[model samples]
Target chain A: AQSVTQLDSQVPVFEEAPVELRCNYSSSVSVYLFWYVQYPNQGLQLLLKYLSGSTLVKGINGFEAEFNKSQTSFHLRKPSVHISDTAEYFCAVSSLGGYQKVTFGTGTKLQVIP
Target chain B: EAGVTQFPSHSVIEKGQTVTLRCDPISGHDNLYWYRRVMGKEIKFLLHFVKESKQDESGMPNNRFLAERTGGTYSTLKVQPAELEDSGVYFCASSQPGRREAFFGQGTRLTVV
Candidate 1:
């Protein structure tokens, strides 16, 4: 079984400030990592994914995440945030296989203030 | 292309009542999954369907929950004798073969009183 841990439950940042949401995972086998964001009253949208290759992956909305295999971490980062970036973020992990169930962390609520 | 969609954005029912939630995956997606978040817990997978067949159901909490995807098009999850612990957000997601990311629905918020 795979599990994900999001260290922070909530993070508050001023508009235009940089932010990083920490995530770590535990799994016996190789896994795939993903970051998803859910805006107010909206569905979960894929921020980015790390399937293989380049540890650093860029995503929409100027967000990016670095996959550190040794540290078992996939932290999401943004150089500058906007008020519209306020949302709930989730870190998920899935085993490397067909139709494997994805496991999500407790989630981190990002509040971007003006 | 249309994204995964769930019906009844919010449902409030009394304990011991039955509730049915529906999900319609994308047009060509063959893989459908059901997941839920109870209270402050993380979202957990309930089941997965490949077309009309149930590929996996290990995450289903109990026998009171039944899910069916007829003809591999749309899916329905029926919960009988709902309990307070069952109140949460139920999300539906879909993905096609060779796709790494699963598109998610807005989810249905269920409250049991």
Candidate 2:
């Protein structure tokens, strides 16, 4: 069994300020973690993913996430924010092998205020 | 290359009405999947199709939902007598054989009144 949690429903940050969205997961077996961003009226875009090797993975639009196995967490962070960055972010997980279904959190809405 | 495409981006129908949503995935992608996000709920997987065959449909809510992929190219999801609880955004995605990553469509927002 696998599950993901994103405590914050919404996070408001000012322009150019650093922000972090926390995500935690629980899985019985080895897993793959991913973060996706969905803009208004747009599809979910891949922000980043952690399959193996590096614990810290960087993604598009300057968004990066660090995978901490011991803590069972993959938190996304960005040093600066822009108006265009306002969107909903999702954290998803899937078991390591085969064509498994992904489990997703409720998602966090990021409101970047200029 | 074109990304996944879904038709009738938004639809509002009365309860007991039937609706069909369509999807056109990227060319040559063998793995296609469907997911739905109900109001205030997390997105959940509905089903997956490998070409013209149903690979996994354990997430399908009920028999009211029917999915088919003709010739392994385009797919359609038909909902018969949709209920109010069925109102949500339906998403379609496709990936290569390995399932490394999947590309998503904009989603079809269905409102069953």
Per-residue lDDT tens digits for candidate 2, residues B1-113, read 89999988999999999999999999999989999999888999999999999999999999999999999999999999899999999999999888668888999999999
CAPRI level of candidate 2: high
- In order, how many clashes per candidate? 0, 0
Interface RMSD of 2: 1.0
Per-model chain A TM: 0.97, 0.98
| Runs in model 2 lying further than 4 Å from the true structure | none
Query: Residue by residue across A1-95, what tens digits does model 2's lDDT show?
Result: 88999999999999999999999999999899999899998999889999999999999999999999999999999999999999999999988
Error at A57, model 1, angstroms: 0.3
Q: Which numbered prediction scores highest in DockQ against the true structure?
A: 1
- Each model's TM-score, in the order given? 0.99, 0.98
Docking category for candidate 1?
Answer: high
> For model 1, which pairs clash?
none
